[model samples]
Target: AQTVTQSQPEMSVQEAETVTLSCTYDTSESDYYLFWYKQPPSRQMILVIRQEAYKQQNATENRFSVNFQKAAKSFSLKISDSQLGDAAMYFCAYRPGGGGADGLTFGKGTHLIIQP
Candidate 1:
């Protein structure tokens, strides 16, 4: 069984600063994909970033980046130049790359609050 854990239940950051959200997972499969999804007030889960287990380089998208530690099974999301629009409930998800009966495992999520 695979599980995702977010140590911090909630976090707050001042506008224009940087914030890193922690995420760790346990999986038996060697090949899989990790994802960070953001859910705003509207409650829609949007893909923030993704990392392939085989990829050595960390994945990044504009102001969003991930520190993927495969050996430790730790994947953290770093949001730079935080803005009010960046506030959301971020979720860490996992799914096998090859596909299987296994469904996407998601963490409890970290609620990010942006302060002006």
Candidate 2:
């Protein structure tokens, strides 16, 4: 069983600042994948970053990066130079390795508020 937890239900950041959202998970599988997704007001889930269990290096995309602590079962997302457009609901998701390629299991979400 895999469960994702987003302790903070809401967060705020000023434009051009940096913000980091925390995530923790419990999973029995030793190998799996983790992802961070952003959903703006439009309500579309966009992949922000992904980390593979076998990889030692954390994944990075543009201004988004992840701090993946495999043993601790924690994967956090960091947004640098946050923009007004970045304000949205962010979800941390997990996909278990093998077994029919398990689909994503997402966290409830964290509402990101951006102050101009």
Winning candidate number (lDDT): 1
- Across 1-116, the per-residue lDDT of candidate 1 in tens digits comes to 89999999999999999999999999989999999999998998999999999998999999999999999999999999999999999999998877657578999999999999
The estimated TM-scores of all candidates read: 0.97, 0.96
- In model 1, state the lDDT of residue 3: 91
Model 2 spans with C-alpha error above 4 angstroms:
none
Q: Rate residue 105 of model 1 by lDDT.
A: 93
Which residue ranges in model 1 land beyond 4 Å of their true spot? none
Top candidate when judged by TM-score against the true structure: 1
lDDT of 2 by residue, 1-116 (tens): 67999999999999999999999999988889999999987877898889999999999999999999988989999999999989999999999987786889999899999999
lDDT of each: 0.95, 0.93
Residue 58 C-alpha lDDT in model 1:
100
lDDT of 1 at 76: 98
